[model samples]
Target chain A: MLDFSLNKIFVEGNTDQKMIATILEIHYNISFPYNGLALEDCIINCNGWQGLFKQVALKEIYRIESSGKNLIIFDADNTSNLGGYTKRKKEIEVGFAELIKATKKNINYSIYLLPNDSDNGDLESFYMSCIKPDKRFFIECWNNLYGCLQSKNEARYELKIPKSAGMVYSYVDLFENYRTGFYQNKKTKRDYSDDGLWEYNFEENNHLKSLCKFLEDNLNLKSN
Target chain B: MPDQSEFITHFEVSNFKKFDHLVVNDIGQFNLITGDNNVGKTSLLEALSLNLKSNNDLVFKFHSLLCDQHIHHHAENKYSKNPIIPKFNYFNLLKNKEELPLTLVFNSQKVILTDIDYFRLKEEDKDLFVSTPYFMDGIEYKYWIRIDKSNVKPEIQFMYEDDYYREDRKFESKLYKPIVKFRNFYERDLNKFIKELSQIELLNLTAFDYEEIVSIIKIVIIPDIIAINIQKINNDSDEMIFIATKSSKGLFVNVTRFGDGVQKIIRYLIEVYYAKKNGFNYFLIDEIDTGIHFSRLKIFWKEFLMLATKLNIQIFATTHSQECIEAYAQALEELGMEEKGRLIEMEEHNGKVYASTLSYENIKAGLISNTNLRGA
Candidate 1:
């Protein structure tokens, strides 16, 4: 059986790539090689959905699927704030129908939506699902603080969630958000040391457990 | 010359050079042979050339196979150097078994070469010999076997069979013309076959080929060169030279004066032009991108692929450069000839040479990922 680390994770951009790598390493203790993943090994940073689709149109997906399992994780940016989950899910399904059809039916591959399969939001929302229930008060305080800051800010664009879900992740158990800046660069910096190894159980965390299951089942990964 | 393209669609070589046996089938119009050093890449080209054409061309390639210019000199004879030469038996796959004949199969035609004792040089009425200097003990005289442009004959053993004109009932036997070749610098008298082609009216180039060469040269070799002129050298022998017209300088310069890179570019271009014009079916080029720059390789391949396809020329070229392979793949993709271009990789396994054709997917992926296909 192939190692879990060999299973390729095709994601939107550098931020998702780093977040996924961090998640796998910190939580699952799986390490990736220097070069981005291919059949031989390395993470494939598709840059974005358009770039990822181009690779698919070029028949690269068939090549990947032939050699090993491919885990395609894209941002389901259809958050409840913008539109209802039901409407957004339909739009995503329709938009990606061609891709889903092109993929070989027998291949061991899966496409997972963020937060929940049918739910809106993205990797950020999914991280929010991993938050401890005890940190509910802190989440409320952070949302209020973000809302106040958003009103005062001159920047025109709306941040889907007022506060970064990654930033909120730092306050919870088993999560350490070391990432900072607009695009993960060191310019706008935040450094937080892990208090200790959180007493987190793999089976207890449903969101993370599902991701591990997908990796295990699709990749035929022999758990270490 | 035959009307239809006599380009070799397939060939099998055995007991020739390093390759004990190699059979390449489903060959494309353009075949690129590549591998590590001493992998029989050049020998494959030689095998193809010999398979497709006359014996005279094979003699020239055999001499310059290694391109080593080691001519032993003596204190007595100052003019020509004594070079150690090998006979036909030296080509046997198993060196100890000299009786085994080197076999070359082209399409359906098979040509078997035997002992060099059958061949002898004739200069006018006198018999030429390769004279060797006396070491300390004794003197030995030999036939002066010049690699190219030699009047060597096979002691008139039997009637010659003309493979091309075999169908024609008028002529009792068919006469064979040499296949086109653009060899590296080591091969002496590069114009021997080209000069012969020029002598034959039907096989000679048309004005259109000259125009095409001019146009191709503008993109491939020297941008400054406007035209090419085949001028007769004012020497005792009938020797022709190529003069490149410098457009900006408004003057013509001998092609020999150009650097190896420019000469290498022009060499293949000339072969391509001749093949296009005279309907020469096959061309064998060794180290096609020897002196050319890495960046210019793509430009060279683009022009080569387009011209070779347009002229229906079957090209078998060998290269040891990674850039050349990538450039070829890129050119094929750009020209929409990815299916037509074939990269034959040669490797030695268990004392025998093995050849495998790289698939389109492999070639494309290798190039995209910067994978080394040369297998060095």
Candidate 2:
């Protein structure tokens, strides 16, 4: 009911939003304008923070007390350098330190980069092996990574992405902009024609409104 | 000691009812004669008035209530350099115990009577001595002393303090009319004599003027309720007034609203004011530590006594509070009033009223040796 001109953030990515919010929420108990919040101000997710720890994002986070909600997130898709040759914890800490330095300017705009670049050296290869570069392909990759990361003891940065992105990401990623596919294990089909989920991808996930409210209310909560 | 400059050095009680053979000497600056409830603290005060000018009927009714017959009240005042001629007087009450021509002599002294004690008095005159002699009952006693000696007059003729304060102030006060001495009646004009007898003014005399101090005390002391308003009134076409406060609803509200500590502080301050304005002369307080919290009791003696000595009011009070005793002792030691003061306690000894002097060490021992404090 009140003016929300400076209240919240609206994220563009699913994994980036949930990972950054869920991680910080669990670790520090510090709430934020999660993925979906009712506000006029702009927002970022996990991918934003680890974006080379860019000076822009850092500046943005710090100005949040005045400017508004500042959220940051990063990609954990590539490097396995997270795990040390002998001492794995050291490698994770050093890697996180580097990422933390990049966004030191804003101080308030905290960053989140997951499944460290050091984790699971080759996730793209594994996800791509099962599914081709089609509509449901990244979805399949999201599901695989999500499930694998669920089992891994890696730092937040090292955790794998969801296989098929838990179907939740289909609403955000543009389906019409790319080709998509789904593996038919029963039919033993390699690439079923017209069986892609390109229509479901990049669609608005309306059911998530309540979920975002839950996140928003749970964190950065306004008390009566 | 130059007779200590007291106007009337001694009193003569004749047919003063129950006071048959009362001869107490050394009328010093502070005389504290205390005993059990009926052991005659009031009787002694009444006998002292025989030397001064006071109402005879009021004095007679006092003896009628005591129901004692024929007591002699004889006294010698320090008006002249002659101890040989004692100023004695006889107030003869008829055999009926009520009717009498209570005649008071100015400078008359029956040297024969002073030389001969009541043990030698004939039974008929002894009958004349007790009854119609001195007032004995508590209420029938009115303080209207007519001073015969000008320069040697009794500044404060006589006073009687009943144990009326503790026993339901509203109900028990009806036991008798409390002593409110009229200045003109007692040969003391209120405005003129006040300059001599007045003690140090606590803060300011006017309650309105003292609002600042009272308010500060209210703040730091945190009283449950505080009121400081002064009103001037006409008494018998003369100005008179009293200062009081609704202070609080009661102790219960104070404890919940502000704290027990604050209530305690306010109480101590009022008591200190009482002691300061009264002078180091005569104080008859029944219970010294009522509503006084234990934690703040220490301040009562340590700081309060310092103020008390300068005001010079000889404090005579009773206390069921062991802390009171302890505080008085500590106060005496700190203020060095121990050597200058006396503590007389009334206790029953073998069914007879007995009194004994208590020193600072005794007070300390009484406090420290109590079984309760040992465990605490």
Candidate 3:
């Protein structure tokens, strides 16, 4: 069972959960199954933005009586019709305010919009930015093919999938020959952090550094 | 149905069993209390029952019931055959031995229960207690039950102030007259069930009430039950409840032969019908889902809430089943009377018990989001 008594990080999807868990483990040497049953216990996947907002509105985030930290991570999804970083943050703040009013517990929590909190994109945007400079050609080639398909109006027919997920899948497949889609099947799902294909050079990427700082300030080691 | 305006809207308990101080506000017509084990859910029901303004005999009866003491009836005294003297340790009711009095407040009416040592009183004072009514000024009309150290049995007495007339004197001072019906989980008294059945027959209920009761029983208990009858056997020595189902043909089968779930639901519905006919406005049930099957919980809650609304009775029931809580929320939504139900989550923190009242909106949100509202 998930140990809700400890600190928690509520993410939008399973990929986000994997990504955050990987970032914490790689950067800070933090490990999973932190006082819980498995690696994904501390970081909960709310399934989607709707599920996350529903949890907030239901005051579920304040269910436990712990002074541990809580981090909420969701994609800005700026490319879609959904709102960007500022708007998503504000929506969460409003829902969180209502929850606080209902529960009245002193919760230590913070919100981080995906792709460096201020970007108008998601975890895919962050991962694309963190790719090794030498390995950038793989994503660039995929993007060029994607643009050609869009010019011929064959993008929907040929790709018919999320562009970022396709780019990540193709990039990882080029080196590992995994041939599997990103987050397609649970049994053969890829671990974004454990995979050595992606180069998360935090020293070179300021956006990644900012996220690490935010995590370092919020995710305490005492809970683990 | 009784007037709905007179129900208790709020209650507070101080120094009661398992609660140093607990306050539950915004009480609705239907309340489902939930918590972890030993969190005092049943004690809250007992506190509510004891807070009711009842006569001395009824008060002692409630005390005995709370203490789990069996009252013995003697054939020698006809009028007072069943003398309910509290036979348990009185200190068990207190939160601590030093906490002098346990106070229960229902709305504005307050009941203070204090235990006094019988051996501490002066000899003259003891002689006065055995004689005529002991009158004193500014006594505050408390139920002073003194327990003898040697026997550990309480001597029940009621003291009044000087201005109170002898004819106007009674136990508990008649602050609130709402009749309370309590049902426990373990004890299924067949004699009490038969008594309630006779009372329901004497109530002369209308056809609609009888039909509603029968339909509720059919929906929640046995779907094949066609008719119910009470028969006396062994030369009127005992009464038995018999039911005729579709499978039973024209003959009636004794209810004792069926499973406990059927008998429990029947006894509960009959008692509730009788209490409603007699103008009862409050019902407290401990472990309300004990004998019933899990699959029948939704229908049971639906029918139970409908009956409570029709009878205008405020219900306070404790539950350990998550399905029961979910069923209650669903039933409230199905009836479109979401405002009438509340879930009181009792929790213990730092040696004090607290209750968090969740409205229908909160409960629905939690249920939809799959949140743990049972405080487990």
Predictions in order: lDDT: 0.54, 0.34, 0.64
- Stretches of candidate 2 off by over 4 Å are A1-224, B1-227, B232-280, B334-336, B349-351, B366-376
What docking tier does model 2 reach?
Answer: incorrect
The residue-by-residue lDDT of candidate 3 on A74-175, one tens digit each, is: 887784647799888888888767766756666567888878888788878788876667677877788788887767766556655345666766676576
Q: Identify the superior model by lDDT, candidate 1 or candidate 2.
A: 1
Clashes of 3: 0
- Best-matching candidate per lDDT: 3
lDDT of candidate 1 over B1-376, digit per residue (tens): 1123666666788876676778776578888887778888876876665542345334433333323222211112222333222223233232345346667777776666653433343332111322322122111111223232222532221111110112222211112222333344532444554454445533355677777877877887777667776655665444344655655375556566777777666657775666545335777788888888998989889988888887777888888888888899888888888888877777664566766555555566555433346742
Candidate 2 structure quality by residue, lDDT tens digits, A126-148: 22322323444555566666666
Model 1 C-alpha lDDT per residue in residues A41-154, reported as the tens digit of each score: 344556544444433212332233344456777666664345445554455455456645644333344566565555566766665555455544555776777777777766
Residues B1-376 of candidate 2 have per-residue lDDT tens digits of 1121123333334444344443332132223333445554444444343332223333433433332323433223322222111122232223223433332222233221222122222223212222232333333333212222332532211211221112221221112211112112121232222222232232235564245436645444444335532222433332222224355443222122334344334333443454344221333343445555665555555554544454454334444555655655565676666664444443332333323343344334334323111100
CAPRI-wise, candidate 1 is incorrect
User: What does candidate 3's lDDT look like per residue over B4-84, in tens digits?
Assistant: 358877888886667777788778989998888888887788777664333342345344443353222211221231223
